[model samples]
Target: MHSSAVFLIEFGAIILGLGLLGRMAGRLKFSPIPLYLLAGLAFGEGGLLPLGASEEFVAIGAEIGVILLLLMLGLEYTATDLVTNLKTQYPAGLVDGALNALPGAAMALLLGWGPVAAVVLAGVTWISSSGVIAKVLGDLGRLGNRETPVVLSILVLEDLAMAVYLPIVTALLAGAGLAAGSVTLAIALGVAGLVLFVAVRYGRLISRFVSSDDPEKLLLVVLGLTLLVAGIAQQLQVSAAVGAFLVGIALSGEVAEGAHNLLSPLRDLFAAVFFVFFGLHTDPTSIPPVLLPALALAVVTAGTKIATGYWAARRNGISAKGSWRAGGTLVARGEFSIVIAGLAVSAGIEPSLGPLATAYVLILVVIGPLTARYTEPVASWVIARRRPSGPASAPEPQAAAEESGGAHDELADTVRHDR
Candidate 1:
């Protein structure tokens, strides 16, 4: 009885604290992800304080958080869309992997963490946070931009790649031999292919069956289906996230939209808890020794991500402006980076990997939004500086006179509009 009360107190305090942190992040106009992780650090093993009874509950919530994150991601697209992305976006995905993923792998090798850790770190850097990127796009009014599709295509392919990547990582972490790993990959790919085939052929049927007039029933059915599929996939040594994602792709039309609407809040809550949970396992004291490497890796990966986005957009015929915008937009990595790192941490691959990942993610997540806002503008400014000042540029006096007149007219128009 005493323990139960203590558990409630700890858990309740955590939720309330998270709410406050999230609210603060909103007002500050940044992702609450870093804040949540920081909060977790504050309450974890070697931080300001530690919880006794509520840790178990938090661990479970973290797992569910991951499932919902993937499910919602899957809900964003149909199997048809996946097929389309695969057909057209393979080159971009390859470039993205080579440019962005290699830095982390190189860094891991440099740190002497061995090949398994290299694979793990490579994944940590390869994928961008779809959640964070989507939110940033919406906030900045880039969702309707021409380059937005280019950005999104890259993300969709990454999502697909993760389906294969996670299972491989799982196999490696489990100490499976090359033979065992091959079998795991084979199972994962086969499962993924089957899910896609089913989704493409019977998606409507699946969604219709899950659809309901009652909101409560709809929520229960969708959530239950996702969990069941996720658990089964985990049992089969396929990634639970991959399973949840396939479920999302399998449900289309009204069912997908309704489930997204209903499950969004749940996704947010659990997702926040998931970030917090990652932080809990990281010792705050371990971060400093890794601070330099994390920063260096963050810088390199940020550049590579921008390059990947820029090249992808350009290859698809996007203009310099839009391509730069896409590049900058992809710089922020959030949820998925942590998700990959969390796996490594749980597998006990390397002690420093968690702290390094924590620091790396925190740095990038904070800088992502800012870079999205400024990268294009900064690029244009540099281009302007490099151009020779010919007769067209030498007309400052005339240009200023014309500009002043235009400003006067614009000010008059603004006054009339305001009136």
Candidate 2:
């Protein structure tokens, strides 16, 4: 009875706190993620007012949070969209991986952490926070922007890569041999392929099976199915999040839309808990030791992410401004970074990795929204300032206008051709 009461009180207070934080963020016109992280820090180890009883439940909620995040993300598009993205935007994905992943790997090696840590850190830096990006896009009303699909395509490629990468990392951290790792990789790939095939070919059947006119039944069925699949995937040494994503992909049409509406609130609640859970495990004091490096890494990677977005957008024939927006939108790295760092920390891979990852994510997540809002205007201002003065600059405006007109005409032609 005592334990139950304690759990109730602690968890209740957490939910209440999150609600207030979210309201405040709404009023302030910014994301509540950083505030959520700060709250976690305060309640976590080495911080003020730590809790004892509710931590385990919070941990489970955090796992559910990740699963729901990936699942909902998967529901946003079809398997056909994924395959199309993989085929068309692969070059951009390659650029993204090389430009962003290299810095973290290089940093790890330079710090004497060896190859494994390098690989882990590379992953941490490589993928942007899909949750954060999605929220920002909705909040900024950029979901329908020309560059938005470009952004989503790049993110999809990264998520698909994670389906493969996580299994390999799991095998490596467990000290598996080369053959074992290869086998694990093969299994992950096979499962992913099967899921994709089913989603593409038999999605209508799966959706019909799961769909219901009753919201209550739909919610129960989808939630139960997702948790079951996620658990089984984990048991099979595949990523639970990947399983959840595949489940989402297998449901389409009205079923997908209905599930999204029913599950969105749940997704938000658990996602907040997940962010707090990340903060809970991190010691506040450890961050200072790595703060400088984390800051430096955040700054460098932010630029690379911007470059990745810009290149991808331009490849898709988006305007310069849209390309800049795409780049800025990809700057924030949240849940996955923490997940990767958490794995390494649990495996005792590197002592400072956790603190560094925490600090790095904090810096970027905070800056992400600001950059998304201002990157284009700022870039325009900088370019204008650098232009040569006098007669050269005077006719340049007319020439630039003509160039822009030509570009728009070409874009219109391309759009019509695509149609």
Clashes of each: 0, 0
- Candidate 2, which segments miss by more than 4 Å at Cα? 390-419
Report lDDT (CA) for all predictions. Answer: 0.87, 0.84
Candidate 2 lDDT by residue in tens digits, 237-316: 77788789888878888998899889989988998998888888888998898999999999999999999999998887
Q: Compared with the true structure, what per-residue lDDT tens digits does model 1 show for residues 1-419?
A: 99999999999999999999989988997899999999999999899989889999999999999999999888888888889889999999999999988999999999999999999999998898887787787677665566777888898899999999999998998899999899989999998899899999888888889999999999999999999999999898778898999899899989988998899899989999999999999999999999999999999999999899989978977667677888998998889999999989999989999999999999999999988888887987897889877655443232333222322232121111100
**Superposed Cα deviation of residue 89, candidate 1 (Å):** 1.4
**Poorest stretch of ten by lDDT in candidate 1:** 410-419
Angstrom error at residue 252, model 1: 0.4
Task: Tell me the lDDT of model 1 at 373.
Answer: 87
Instruction: TM-score each candidate.
Output: 0.93, 0.91
